[model samples]
Target: MNLKESEPTASASLSRRKFIAGTGLLLAGATLKLQANPLVSGAPLSTLFAEPIIDIHQHTDYMGRTTDQLIAHQRAMGITKTILLPSGRPVNSASTHFGVGNGLQAKATGNTICYGLAKKYPKEFLFGANEVPDVPEAIEEIERYLKLGACVIGESKFGVECDSPEMQKIYELAQAYNVPVLMHWQYGMYNYGLERFHKMLEKYPKVNFIGHSQTWWANIDKNHLDQKVLYPKTKVTPGGLTDQLLSNYENIYGDFGAGSGLGSMTRDEDHARIFIEKHQDKLLFGSDCTDITGHIDNCLGAKIIAEVRKLSPTKKIERKILYHNAKKLFRL
Candidate 1:
């Protein structure tokens, strides 16, 4: 979560840790401090690795941001290539509430905007297509972008059941095109039904699935209550459903995007270290951040990259998540 334009906020009495843990939002406007990078001969991450880091998640025309703002934000965060996910349909503010666990709302951007950005800046941007599953024009609109050479087909962030027939149609298109599908798996909110998603996984073996959102990250805990507890700060017990899904399914992957992702890693550093090593091959780096500053103090995306850089067992594995895996998955 934590996209949208609203600044990070919490109750007056809450501490930074509690605020971030509770809201699952990034700690915006904090002071900047550079972390050491062992892989690049101790260079700061912002200035080094200028060619390989790929941001697998981002948006086009997010919060009314201009093209310059978007490009500057990515470049400053050390993102060499960005996967721009445009929204499928307009969101209903009444249904998609601004709760602590849910993502903030923004006006939907069409597939053509993403297509234009990726086309104009081929090296720096890659575009995706999306549409509300239940809408009659869903498959046809999505297929139009796919035919126009869209790399992926989602941020399938609509309020639909995970296994809805319309959603399956999107998966079928993904299978036909042989392209990866990125889904925002917010429990009870976006892409409903996390526990039973394995059926789709089994049914569509050829389509690569990338999972994101608070629910996806919270399920890193085996004991995660099957409800609205989005950012659980408890010590992680191994073999959680998320871990199991990543381990058991070759086509499934995790996106370390947004504050919920950072929260999962921060909840228990020890668990994060072990989890990184175990699923190094399946994890993908994606920062579903909305800030434009691009500084580590303000950018949630850069912070996720920093966490991966600090925790990966090896630089090779780090590079795989940061760039190579997406390159192979998206054929970039």
Candidate 2:
């Protein structure tokens, strides 16, 4: 399909912005506290695993925290390395936190902020370039950052289907640059049409696609029937699409971060254990938690590390999930 042909007309785009603005007011009343604590305790995850961790999924801006606070927080969690993914789209109307901006402006702001952080803390933080796949200058914008050493392309939170022609263009960019494409896949939010996403995997054999968010996690249970596809706490059944996809696709990977990731692991211990063991090499450790506490226990990030350690049959496998796998994939 020709994606450019499907682009919304100017009038339609304007109307959509108006609608978003109207709804944004209702959400603007809520606020996020992005301050950093003076004393951050690093004892939680440090006591759990001796191996240093590499968090492949994280954000520098969305939480409203400064770069210094972000670095301090990662250190507190024993994260030796972190990939800072910036969102290309505006903070959604329903979201109470993150700044309000969209499209090129937002993407530029995130790229500038993350790149600065990466430069300051060269060893600790690495950054990715984010672009809205459906935008007109997406490829050009992404290429500009890739030339400047963006190791990854994404946290793509655009309103497009996973297999849309627009996303294919972005995948081409990733393949050209030899970098992974990280995506946020919520059913109704960014990267819709998850059921047909396998076609993209088949097509882009060289482009690594890291899947995140509720829609991706929902498919972990083969019996997941709800269309809502957000935060399902029921016991997970085997033979889920996520497992099947990981087993079959070498380039596809899982970002185990945020509420969806921790919930998936904690919802069913037996299922999570089996899943982790089965796809140990394909899953990457991440802390999508934006909380400023710096301690893992203070947020779901700590629980995720603890769960992975508990479920991993051996220290070797635990290291693979928590640190080694990300090291290899991102080439840290």
Candidate 3:
């Protein structure tokens, strides 16, 4: 009698409680399997902690998902707070990539939507302002949002160098407002000339720069080849710029979100452990995940959380990466 082979009748409506219970069972089974054949030397998820998470990197309009759904998903993940970043005016290249015209308009709409959500759920949600750095009036636009209580400045996906004159101006604004600037650093996509990004770091000593995406994570390995910064490689070699920057720069931070964040951990568990422990102060937990399910088992965010717990030498460090670091950085 294979119960798995049975089909439900049209009238067999599954209750939400039953669906949640089934999902939990499935996740428990998966956890057991991983524990049996651990991916690393020890089981990373052996001791699961249900600490509150602060997701610093999320969008309001990912895949047309609504604010209601996004909030619900965050609640499901035990995320106590989330910062919503709005995309700035798209560069021509970005516009083509996303199949949208007028990046500024898109950003404005996102800001409005996110602001509304934050107003509606003041404790659970916060919003950021965004503008293409190269555009005229960019500073004015950012100032407007800053005045309106925007906590961060970005998701700055532009087709310009990180140290471009326009970006410098925005950095100045961030310094004035004492707000952190979040950047998506994909080599060819956004923030071109990442190797030279250190110049901006030096120039704006007061502004906190939170890095995200493949290029930033790949550089975690010192021996990461220039050609492979956008690609994920298994096995890591120490001496990457990320470690050096975090060690040296007080204003720079890492956003552990998306495939890039998880890849950095799973690629080399040993190095990851050391890296997290070494730079726990500057590292933050984020979920650039777009899935509606909000289940960590199926999300890269969950994998990163598990890996952080496994690698962290102490429960205190795990809590910092999951919540405290973001809380301190954002002044939450």
Candidate 4:
């Protein structure tokens, strides 16, 4: 699930019927060849209306990218704005890089980087502060980012469940500041399952938490599931826990960012349609992709967008997922 540089591999074996069922392309107008719409029209009246796209989740480090280069890559992919978090604290104090801090939390200086990006690309970037909850300064760091105008607080990759008490405290702060919290909800393959996600939504109604990666995608089932053993490699049929979460909760949202995350949801047409139709508003488009080459090609974005276009739903609900919902949620 840490897929920092991996390609899509999970659903590569899906058959054509399964693809149709998973993505819903078979139910739509036609296999509309996916293309970048410079001037989009014929959009659904019910979908959220906003400009183009604003990718609310991403990470950027100085592997080989400059600020200008980052912005240019995003623009090419139709991203009007982006939210970035530092990779982590530096391992060596003598190193100029911001230390990777404790395994998952951002250092105080992380807020500085976010604030700086917001200042530089006021129109094209927004700040989301990342902090590890167990860190001594976690509470103070959240307050600092809020004061400095961070619109959101995390794509917090916890090695635990979302409903843990430590996370509850962070959710409390997010609720207080009216900022969204983006967290990685991946638990191998249904590690925490749907019940955990539902509990989080029930307990933290005021806090908006964006779900990402495999665990969230794997849970969307509406009926009795047909068990197929993909044996030691264990793969469940789509649409079990994920569908339930989307249909039941308004505050809970999905961030389709990781490669496995994207592949699981979009590999089949029926699965894609069910996901799009049932949770269009709840799904937020993102790539979880970084690095200079990936940015330039916007590879992840292009691939997922093509998958959505292939579905060709009666409505272009994708616009809302890819852009407007994020704009409204982050107030970007």
Against the reference, the lDDT scores of all candidates come to 0.80, 0.78, 0.78, 0.61
Q: How much is 312 displaced in model 2, in angstroms?
A: 1.1
Query: Per-residue lDDT tens digits of candidate 1, residues 1-332?
Result: 55544554565336767866756534322212233332223344445555578888888767777777887788778787898887765544322343221222554366878889899878678888887667678899999998988888888876678898888999999999989999887777788889999999999999999988899989888888755888888899988888989999999988899989999898998999999989887888887777887888988988888888888889888888898888888887
Model 2 lDDT per residue over 226-312, tens place: 858588888988888887888899999999998898888889988888898899899989888776666655867777888889989
| Model 3, span 188-284: residue lDDT tens | 6677887888878898998999998889999988777774457676688877888778888899999988888988888888888888889989999
Residue runs of model 3 more than 4 Å from their true location after superposition: 1-50, 90-109
Location of the lowest summed lDDT over 10 successive residues in candidate 2: 30-39
User: Which structure is stronger by TM-score: 3 or 4?
Assistant: 3
Q: Give the TM-score of candidate 1.
A: 0.81
Q: Which is the better candidate, 1 or 3, if ranked by TM-score?
A: 1
Alpha carbon deviation, residue 135, candidate 3 (Å): 1.9
Error at 220, model 4, angstroms = 3.0
For model 3, the local distance difference test gives 0.78
RMSD, one per candidate, in order:
16.1, 21.7, 10.8, 17.4
Q: In candidate 3, how many Å is residue 176 off? A: 0.5
Weakest lDDT window of 10 consecutive positions for candidate 3 = 38-47
At residue 64, candidate 4 shows an lDDT of: 42
**C-alpha TM-score for every candidate:** 0.81, 0.80, 0.80, 0.70
